[model samples]
Target: MSEVDNYEIVRQKLTLGPLTTPKHRKIRRLLKIFWNEKEINLLSHFGPADEYNSLKQLQERSGLPKDEIKQILRNPLRKGTISKRGTKYCLEPIIPGIFEKYFQRSRDTEENLKKAAILYWDLFKEVLPQQDTKVDNDWSLFRPLLPLEANEKIIEINQEFDVQSQTLPYESVKNLIDKFEQFAVITCQCRLVAELSGEPCKVAPSEMGCFIAGPGSQTMIDGGIRGARLLNKDEAIEFLKETEKRGLVHNAVFDKGDQSSIFFCNCCGCHCGVLFPPKLFHERGAYQSNYSPKWDNDLCTKCETCMKKCPQKAIYHKFPVKSDSSDEQMVLREEMCIGCGVCAINCSDKAIKMVKVRDNVPPDRQKIGNKTFIEMLQ
Candidate 1:
């Protein structure tokens, strides 16, 4: 075996997630087929998603000349293995990490783009089966990022904490997007994958629905990992409103606890990486937002529209089997609900509302402090 044939080492080290396991072996082989020996070694220079190295660091480690190191970095960078942060490069996170990297490219031949998209889609197929809903304490690599319900609709708030603090963005959707210094919106990676794979988006168009914010927004912009829109606060708010109007779910991602993300994504149950897989695999408790859905039957007309849109399948119809009135109502399974607001917003009767699930546990603190929010799902 030649030196770079050891791509498994490169593959295993690519993620900083808790999901490091044998399920990804086939995925590693697929990714290696896309690169050559030296390219995989250059790929090996990267560690976890948070592990970044300067070109100088990589050159020293590889014993290769600086120019060769720079040239070598381009291929894997384009393949979505290594990502650039200013002049530094790190292994991208596998879930939302590598999924978004392809769309970040400013330009690619249509054929090449399709190929890469399919590769990613198949790779995810390998990942999904490895997960079993029967396993207790299961959670997704990415979770549903529930937006803050409109103030009038908000039934309760976590009294102990404020998400408005600089450290945490989950207080509400308001705090998540507004607090970031830099912001860029790009195509929803999952939606794009669905489209290129010919399934098409059942929900919204695959456009600029994902975002990168804070100082890292600039990194994505500079590295071409995410097409940067550079939105100001108002533009960002309006951008999020676009998703809300379309009934898409807003999710904040935390991989290895890099929750500094005031970064948010508008996801559809049909196409979102975070929302689709868990539901597809019957892994309901795998991911959740900070809240759950509250339904008021007084306003509901038994509309199944929300049920069609719920990614988690958390909403179901309940009938009064013995009642003479023959009234049926849409209800939520509290244990499975992620509070993503799909049913609430799309309801013509407006019967559903998002209420605090872990009212005592503050979302803002979860970024810097406890894993209570994620723990709640488990």
Candidate 2:
């Protein structure tokens, strides 16, 4: 089929429910087919959606005939710059109103339309069976509005860390919060899913890294734009305290040195590409923690309680070693472990305990923030 014809087909498929206006659907489909397919997929992955697929992989998996697929990929109407990164292709911002129009919806239209849009993007790439990655513990999320000038202060604070290795001073954290005039309750899409589903979210609200400032910041705020639910220092603290009361945790607090903002993340073990290994993206760093979990076999009864409680599914159970006879043994996958205290909390034998593991940041933090936040915007 010609690119135009394919675009029509996609548009027809996308039209559903009250929100799917004919014009809107046509525009979305045209953009999808005409622009870089990889860029569309990347947007879906980065946005508040659940689509994650590489462009080339999607092309190979597409059942369309080679000629038709090539025609769609090479369509001239898809007027956008393509950015290639190690086989990945992304579409530059070509159409001005694409995001605004695509996301426009009445309250009732959201659930279904959002799902359809996400599924459409997934069609282009692989969807691995969902697995928890075991990095959920020791994380947090919060949205605080602070002064934009605080970004400079944060840079100064980080400069001190450049020469020394110590936890952020309580005074520094307090000073930044006090200086900021406003804050916003930033909600992550992944965390939103957990809340809507009534599932126990694994990531803490505090553990989320700040990426709105400095050289590698992942968040973006319009300069001097003040319209959201901005909170002052006292209000911000109250908001965070309420979040914790609702069972959410905080991992870290950051002063971006600009607008006062708090990042609230709902992280999981799996699907959180940032928390996993193989370092798919160079811009993101690792997840860091101040503590690790220690196992005492003597207290263990070979029970598998820890394995079941693990959100990342990192823990395993095995039988004890047989001195001379044949018996099963229990074991823990330390490599896959994220040192969350869930296993220890649930362990009947009390064999697991969280102890200070190291002082370095975990590699996954940078990856998730950079890939999902910064790279997507660029």
Report the number of the highest-TM-score candidate.
1
In candidate 2, what are the lDDT values of residues 311-334, reduced to their tens digit? 445566664468742455455565
List candidate 2 stretches off by more than 4 Å.
Answer: 1-108, 117-188, 191-261, 270-291, 301-303, 321-330, 345-350, 357-378
Model 1: runs farther than 4 Å from truth?
1-4, 21-29, 44-63, 78-80, 84-89, 106-109, 132-149, 154-169, 176-184, 212-238, 254-261, 360-378
lDDT, model 2 = 0.35
TM-score of each: 0.75, 0.39
